[model samples]
Target: MICCLSSLSTCVANLELKVKKNIIFRSGSNDLFKPIAGFSILLLTAWSMQILSIRFSQLLFIFFVLFALWPVARKAWRKSLEGNIFSMETLMSFASLGALMINAVHEAAVVLWLFHIGESLEHYATQRARAGVSSLMAIMPETVMLLDDGILRAVPVSQLKPGDEIEIAPGGRLPADAILQDSMAAFDESALTGESLPVEYAKGQQIYAGSVIVDRVCRFIVTSEQGCNAIDRILKLIDEADAHKSPTERFIDVFSRTYTPIIALLSMMVMIIPPFFYDQPWDMWFYRGLAVMLIGCPCALVISVPAAITSGLAAAARRGILIKGGAALEKLAEIKVIAMDKTGTLTEGRPTVVCVITDKPDDEDRVLSLAAGVEEGSSHPLAQAIIRQARKRFNDYPIAGNRQALSGQGVKGDIDGRDVNVMAPTFAPPFAPDSILQGETERLQDAGLTVVVVALENVPLGIIALQDTLRVDAKKTIQALTAMNVDSLMLTGDNPRAAAAIAGQLGMKYQAGLLPRHKVEAVYLQQIAAPTAMVGDGINDAPALRAADIGIAMSGGTDVALETADVALTHDRLAGLPELLHLARRTRTIIGQNVTISIGLKIIFLLTSMLGVTGLWVAILADSGATVVVTFNALRLLRTEKTLPQMILKENS
Candidate 1:
């Protein structure tokens, strides 16, 4: 025993030193490692001394137990003094000390060793998950090119303010959200929006921070100050979201807190009641009680929940799905209904002019130019579509003055000394002699086109029909969701006819003409049927997203939407939605399996200990074995690629 313990001690010491050095070099020195290492060595030394002679073995073994007990003793004592007597440390300290009282020194040593290993594993797993998120923060550039006094000096990003003009060379990242000063440039927005392809931005367009300039050198004026850009806010939101605890974790915490004292009391009863009631030998019953304590140690059950959750979180992060925490992942699995916004969520948010209907064929250019001039100052998707079509037809158009937006209606301005208004048909004033234009507008709306009625002082000019094209993968995504037995619905502020037309194409339900508040109400109504998830990519959907059981935001969504959502599809693809749901369901199933194994094994071992069928070594082995099984089972969640590929293949088929 002395030779074996000495070799183990030397091995442990060398291993500890190597691990400590690696940890310190990677994450700075941790204070807890030193004491654990010191006490571990002390326990080994005391055990070695005991093995030298039988005469001194008993006394030295007691000393060995005390040396090993010090750290747990201090922790349990401090927690007890602070009114936290029901902690796992308290349970462990009592259990190990009880083992020593029964003269099972080896069992006590093994118990403490296994407990320490479990703690280390839990801590390391958590740190690894956090490191995955911290890597995103590392992408931010420290300095940026500032065009100060036209000299173009390199300055720290922290010194940048809104309105500052910064020069970005090709292949450089944008340090802040800014308006483009150059005519046009292509950018790789994958870091921010998760869009794999390069996006082109015209002059005066707003580009966010973290976008890489992929084309020629460009200059832009900053719109957001330092520390307030999209990338900075994303990092902050991830930190906040990751801190939330899952339901399973919370239940385990409460269960463990209540479990320790009850088990300790049961061990005490086993020591006292059997000796008195059955006239059993006191030493025999006492040893059995100690074994019972070892068997009932809640180490396996306590560590199981977090191990599985952390593994699931890390796996999801690797796939570009940012589930806020284990709770969000669990909730995602329970979502039976998914309420989605129409624009940006199911379709490309960028609208294009699909048809230009004019009352007179020759006046097409005039009507388009007048509507485009009024919409030039507007940033709405439909407005941009008209402007794009106008630019394609005529390069130079009269500029509009006194431009103003009519909330939920359209834009109004003075173009060529005449009052021009561009709006939806419902928001347009009555036109008595325009039955032909009215008929055309109805026909376009019925075809799912968003018609913009152009009027010159209440006299209709023509109808410019625009439509937000459905995503190529939208039908496939809906079909996949259906195959998973999940219902899909579209909630939009567009006209009911248009909304129904798109929904019919996708073969899903829809609630149209919904304002922001109406969307929230719709989400709440859907939740009555089953657990619901709201997916969107705009500020208007933020409220509805918050109202649902789980909020999934697109990567290209607004910061408010992203911050409010519980899950983010970083790749900005609906294809990831079904994949995320599948992962969440698998994670829940794994957690259930882990909890069952941990608890079931402990119960079986506990019964055997009470019947005197198991001894100290067997009890220790059972406890440690259960922990190892649960941990490995949880780690299986990290290799979810096997399941994900099948899911993708099925979706493709």
Candidate 2:
């Protein structure tokens, strides 16, 4: 009796352990893990019982089939109660239940299991793509050091206001957009601009958020409000861009909505019509109708477009190109004419004093000194260039007083009690009409130099020739665009001679002396022929950028330009433009291929199933196989290098 009692105790212990394991599996936090684990357990139990007893095996099979079908059935029922009955869940539910009715329980279980697995895989891919953008937003620190009352105190970034002084540790990222103060250092701006080189900045220069201080401690005065930093703005743009759907995505959504119900109606007809016309058994046609229903599921077609678009967007973002959305990417592929700004788009935008000509030849230093003193306080690019040159030549100079800025002209001030003016050539003529100076001015203008004339008391002191050099890749970029059959044009407010000179070097057409309004009109004219893209990096280009079909902005561009643009190149280079266009075209091609594969497979399987040439397992293979193929094909966009070889070879040819 004691031995029997000990054996019973062992049996109770094993049962308790089994119950605990079952509870843990059912209560797990992962929604996907629970369904997958339960399905596997039920499938194994059902298959194992088949050798013991046929009756018992059938019961276990039915039990497991229901176990796998519960979630799909619940979802379909909910959708049906809401009067929206043509979802994927509804089709899958009907197919599986029909299979069960025909004693095809094993097939029913395997189909639902495969469908769930596909759903999980697609969800994971989408989440991974979205994580790439989310990682950008996570780079900012939650706390920052505030220099309050000359003392350092740690505070939340949201509490820091504009105009506050902040101290940054050597390796800390900048908390907000700021102006460098009291120090100079090299910064790693790669996170923001994707430029690998460390940029050197001195005191009084603007520093954007997300820049890391690499070498020394720095202090900066904040220039932007809390939550309004450059990174914040970029994140906002990314979010808005992701929310906008492409034309293909919208079409698929509509097609799926209309297609699902039609398939259901067809399946019903296949089940009911054959018995009336032929002498075939009822169960035979019923089974065929079930196979038809399984084959008609629109899983592959519904997921194909979005998967490719999301992958394309993520790939572009990794390469420092911000495509606003799938629609913008689609538009980019169709761009036939590229209207680009002269300064900051094709050229460096930083004009430097390349040549200095003096009437007396010995007074070059004096002419530059006077011009620099007058331009000392101005923030214009040309003014800064003059000041930089003056500091290099003469470290000490007399300060100018009573300074006044002339709109579109240059500046006027009192230097050594003499009225001095430094102006553009359009504002004033050469002080002395000497043939040598006139010839020099013409020569410089022909060479694409912006000649600034300096006059002392209405007499010309000399002319300072400044030039905004073409970007290193400007010619190559133009060639690539031409190879792609995209016509390139330069639109600028500068003189026709200078514009022509620059355009000639790049082999592009030019429309010179364009005001902001004129640039808008030019974009409209270009768009009349074909879709146009406007590339610019200044507030003046905002209107024109908005007018074009696609607007691309340089990363170092003004905030207004960035805000107005539909696409942004994170590095101030045109090399990314070709890659972006390539990606868009490849994405379009993949989407087309996916749609064709999905619809073609469905049509073939539908015909075969109706003719009784395909059975339940074959229908399942068609549905699952098409889904897998389309998904994997769409994922090819994640490796953009694979898409460039053919395009590169074509360009070389």
lDDT of each: 0.79, 0.82
Model 1 scores worst on lDDT over the 10 consecutive residues at 23-32
Error of 2 at 192 (Å): 4.8
Could you give candidate 2's per-residue lDDT for residues 170-230 as a string of tens digits? 8899989999996579998877655577888889978888889989888999998877876
What lDDT does model 2 reach?
0.82
For each of the candidates, the C-alpha root-mean-square deviation to the true structure, in angstroms, is: 5.1, 5.2
Q: How do the predictions measure up, each by TM-score?
A: 0.81, 0.87
Worst lDDT 10-window in candidate 2: 23-32
